[model samples]
Target: MRALVFPAILVLVMAVIGHVLTLHLVPSVIMGTAMNRLAAQGAALHSFRLAPRTTPQTQLVVRPSPDLAYSICAYHLRGPQPLRIRAAAYDDYGSISFFDARTNNFATIRIEETAPDSSGPDILLRGPAGGEPDGLFDGHDLKSPTPRGLILIRRLAPTQQAYDRVKAIASADVCALSSSAGTISE
Candidate 1:
């Protein structure tokens, strides 16, 4: 019974450690897998007319337009590696997100905002492998406890026709919303 108890305790301790380690590592594992996927995607995206540049090993900064201030700087979210995407915009609340040229997908995070760190102007677009963008938006253009704005992303529509295609998609979504609202009113 004593020997059994010792082994059981040892097993329990190992299990606890394993769970703790997994919890800490899950985000990394997920990000890595995503990066691998993105790397394959980026290879295809190079054809798009985006000036994809690798996230430089050194940090880069984008100064605000004088005192106008921005909720987010679209450039910082660019990359630690070469990232290819159609067009990117600073959404309503100002989160810099973008569309992937390869997969025409979108992604975002707290890419930047109020009182951000001066350390990194990281990359957001991942390679076929995952990329981590600078998670800071250093400057407050809004009130207290800032909002995490949506970083609207779209595949780079370099031409009029490509733009039209994206525009149509947007119009469709907007139309759907408006139609739903109208029906709800009735």
Candidate 2:
């Protein structure tokens, strides 16, 4: 009986220490991996520009999902929102990673409506990061300045309120993004 108790106590003590260490250690290990990748990709690349196409701006413009990161070759706004892309992209930012938005290991873009009586993130963009962007524009290979980190036009998604409020800067133009295939020039 004494021998049994000693083994049991040792097991219990070991379990407690393991559990406590894992609580913080496991998370740091997992989160650290992702952070390392983002860093390896390099802090938001800051050397690209969008060239306006002569098209009449009749296409529905969309930005790519940040998780589906890729080289943003070009992005344009024909509507009145004064659309601007605050982004940091890599040289190979044109890679795409589209997956199921509901249940997938990868990131996704979800939609939600804001309440009239409250201020909050109305439309939810369910990625590794969550956001309530008013509008969201997405395309695999878009032409833009910053070519990475889920380039958001800060609420470019289509909805009743967004359509009405930001229609001026809104356009049906679908912006395209992709890798340049050579050394990026300044």
Candidate 3:
């Protein structure tokens, strides 16, 4: 009985350790691979760029939907600066999602969430440590808990013709660092 008790306790301890390690490792592995792939594609910091078409060859992100056009902007709040994202209002469905380094989504803005009277799409994002923004131009303000993260822009395009149109609209979208001189440009 004594021997069995000791072995059972050891097994339980090992199981707990394994579980904790897995929880910590999985997100790191996934985020690391994504960051590496984005780097290889020449995705600059604080800039938005179109993601490659979902093909059997592309492995940066899993389960890519062929019916959608995806774009990404990688950001690092080194100086705790704000990021400005702008997209003209369109008739089709679209969204912008913010994810942290650990792959946790902190904030998301979608076309449906915008007011019907809203003129256009714009967002002001700051790091968790940054201050609030003022004088936003009908923009939504969001805070990210992490200093480094990704901004993903997804637009629906069910058919080739729709895809072309959405692609053109997405091409005009901009993500860039806000200037410190009280001016914003994309």
Give the top-scoring candidate (lDDT). 3
**Model number with the top TM-score:** 3
| Ranked by lDDT, top first | 3, 1, 2
Candidate structures ordered by TM-score, highest first: 3, 1, 2
List model 2 lDDT by residue over 31-92, tens digit each: 34533443454423222222122123521233333222122212122221222222222121
Question: Candidate 3, residues 1-186: lDDT per residue as tens digits?
Answer: 887998999999999999999999899688877977897888887787776555568646778888777788888877667888765455778888899989998887885466566545678888877776765444778888878888888787767787677666666777788863245665
- The CA lDDT at 172 in model 3 is 71
Question: Can you give the lDDT of residue 64 in candidate 2?
Answer: 31
Error of 2 at 37 (Å): 0.5
| lDDT against the true structure, each candidate | 0.31, 0.29, 0.76
- Look at candidate 3 and tell me the lDDT of residue 100: 91
TM for every model, in the order presented, reads 0.33, 0.28, 0.82
- Deviation (Å) of 66 in candidate 2: 7.0
